[model samples]
Target: MDVKVQKNLLCLSREAAEFGPFDAILELEGEPDALWFYREHVSRGVPCIWRGAVAHWPAVSKWSNDYLRETVGSKEVSVAITPNGYADAVREDLNRFVMPHDQLMPVSQLLDVIERKEDFPGICYLQRQNSNFMEDFAELWKDTDLDIAWASKAFGAQPDAVNLWIGDERAVTSMHKDHYENLYCVVRGEKHFILLPPTDRPLIPHMKYASARYQLDLASREFSVVDEKDHGVIPWIPLDPQKPDLNRWPQYRHAHPLRCTLKAGDMLFLPSMWYHHVSQSQGAIAVNYWYDMAFDMRYAYFQCMDAITDTVAEGNCCAVGDHDIEDEQELSTGKT
Candidate 1:
């Protein structure tokens, strides 16, 4: 058999034997100690949900629209506005990967649009991940913890970024992995996640496209795609987990996706380098802590696998930091 064909068969076999065994994400009733968390989930690269992890958090009960308005309504914050709910996703019509139009608005105005009390021309999301909870919404910090105690102890460091996310139901996070161990906490509504482990990287397809940004014309309430002429190109996963086009990307058929819905007060320990696509209920609010992934043997091994997969997939090199739109201040993209 040919080398590429052999690699493909190997991936299929691995999917059957190794990947298919773990059909569900482990859900824990109470918070585990740092040692238990590391041994069971963190060290092994397993994802788990700690039910009612932050149920006692004041934010869970106090973070209503009226409360938010009373607390931080007048504050000016960054919002990602897009014609469609998708920010930082492949725009098939334009044949480009586009970022959302970043707009500055008061917290009150953003809530108005989310609540449908006021008619907004475009979908607005406060999904900026640059520690927005600490910097932008500092006034509301008293409601939630600065960092998860056990998680910080297990990681042996403070969180690099604590992000706040509040958005419309249509706002979708595209499939991508991060170089950080993420602890995502839902405060208001439910968030649905479609997760694929790093071991299944061989089945995922990546494509390179010219980068663009959404430019909104407030006067006419229209969005235009503006090409990033200077930035050149970016490699992104164009596959939508909700509707995987198997014909175009057949390898995706071999991928095993674990679906989980995180309701209010739930915290999901999303391991590093796991590809995920996320969607949320309307007016959902969330906060996530990103701890930098250790560049250890596991990371080096992953790089080797990534290189081999790319080589076997017609020389498609895995783009490092391409999907690092979480830090939009440094990276440019519309979605997280």
Candidate 2:
């Protein structure tokens, strides 16, 4: 991008952080009224945590490792296996965005892999997002709510999907945005989230990479990235928030990141289009409801911003003249 455009983008990010209501995530002692939730948080696209909101959930206490092993141990379910813990992330080594190899295995065996009680060739994660909890683990639905009552009422519809996540610390969810408003509840252990607002889109680098998948070689007990020529290229964020490369992505320096940890029984209201990267404690379990976001003016404005960013990134737009240098200097200096 042109230097002037980059500086302006940086300025926009700074202003967002400065003008935003809370520097850190706001925590609610309890659930708010459905009208308040929709009016304040959902409509405004703000994130908040409801402390111990799901504490009364039966799964929070009953879904122990032994109990899980006893309840659904013999059931065959899909598991994501990767050489490294990252399931769906940019594999810089291969210059491709690789997805984990989906393997079907018994729940008991998967638990053994998670606990390190058995030798496994790859890291294992049960992270199927296709409403796997409802589809496969129907036995466990009795332990948790089918849908958050307040959330459904606020969204004016039931969740499109309810996902179950069971993974260890090694499994990491790469930074990305979703199109659905999310209600994430931690049932066991802890979940760490690094969040960024959608307004920081210009500061975050989005690159196109070929799609690939990890395939394990049973004979060699190894994994390799196999390109999916038919899938074509995918747009993804390459920058890692934990260890950012400032030299390549200098605009990210101006971006603001909010960090929050969700303990067992905690729930986070993640607004649509917000960027989030996640990591979890060993054997952490979570269930999240995805409600489709409204295609309102907010989304329309974001789409416009995204188009402008793409144009700026491609250097298709003309640079600001020398007369604008003073304004650029002011932006860089954090001056009005």
Candidate 3:
């Protein structure tokens, strides 16, 4: 690492430690007005929780397993399958970053796997983030509003995508940042989030890993890692927030991670470009809205900082300017 770049990172780490939001995420007992949300949380790029924000939504109580089975059971849905319940995460065993094997199956079958009613070969999660709620699960639309009126008004537009999430306890979302302002609501079980503000970017490490995918052998109930050489290499964070290996990535010791749990009916406002890792209780169900982020001065500054971090970590200053930064939201659904 270049001495100047290392010094810059050290300075950033100190700044975050001295002046960052070291406290817990601000919690609001009820929903706030659009303008207040825009000014306090959105514009400031901070996270806050609205306790029981969506408690009134009928889906909170009605979207149970029986309800889902009766509604979308027959419909085929896209499911991300992995042996370890990690989709689009760096797998140290394979020494590569692997993406889940997408499988199409009936909603009932997927529920069976989640409910442990059947002995499934792999961990299954309904985490397709391409507006799957609006596009695929139309039957459940009436249960929840299409858009959050306050949030839409605050953002000055409707969400670009409304994602539906349902997964097992083991299904963990790796730590990463996204380009969209996210509003996440939990309707079923609980979701635990470990969040690090964008200011902590310098302390977080990034590495390029070989691209790969998981493939399952049904008859033998075995899973194999397949390399995707065509896709070349991909950059990913190898650190596990639950148990970060400080020895390998020592800079991470300076990071301050704020933890929060969103239970049924609670909503979380996750600002754009904030690094977050998520875990859930068994059969946790949630929905989230992704609003396009403004590519203004803040984004430009973040990009510049990202470039510097990459240069310091890799000893290749040109690496950042040469490649387009991959959209973290596109590859993963845990933007919240």
Best by TM-score: 2
lDDT of each: 0.84, 0.89, 0.86
lDDT of 1 by residue, 190-275 (tens): 99999988877767777788999999999998889999978789888988999988777765665679999999999999999999
User: After best superposition, candidate 3 residue 56: deviation in angstroms?
Assistant: 0.4
Task: List candidate 3 stretches off by more than 4 Å.
Answer: 16-20, 316-336
- Clashing residue pairs in candidate 1, if any? 99-334, 100-334
Lowest lDDT block of 10, candidate 3: 319-328
Candidate 1 regions exceeding 4 Å error are 1-9, 12-21, 315-336
C-alpha positional error of residue 102 in candidate 2 after TM-score superposition, expressed in Å: 0.7
TM-score of 2: 0.93
TM-score of each predicted structure versus truth: 0.90, 0.93, 0.91
Candidate 1: worst 10 consecutive residues by lDDT? 317-326
Candidate 2: residue 255 lDDT (0-100): 77
Query: Best by lDDT, which number?
Result: 2
Count of clashing residue pairs in every prediction? 2, 0, 0
Model 2 C-alpha lDDT per residue in residues 1-336, reported as the tens digit of each score: 366665576566667777765389999988789999999999888999999999999999999999999999999999999998998999987889999999899999999999999889999999999999989998898999999999999989999999999999999999999999999999999999999999899878898999999999868999988998998999999999988887777667667789999999999999999999999999999999999999999899899888878888787543332333457558767665
When summed lDDT is taken over every stretch of 10 residues in candidate 2, the lowest stretch is 316-325
* TM-score (C-alpha, index-matched) for candidate 3: 0.91
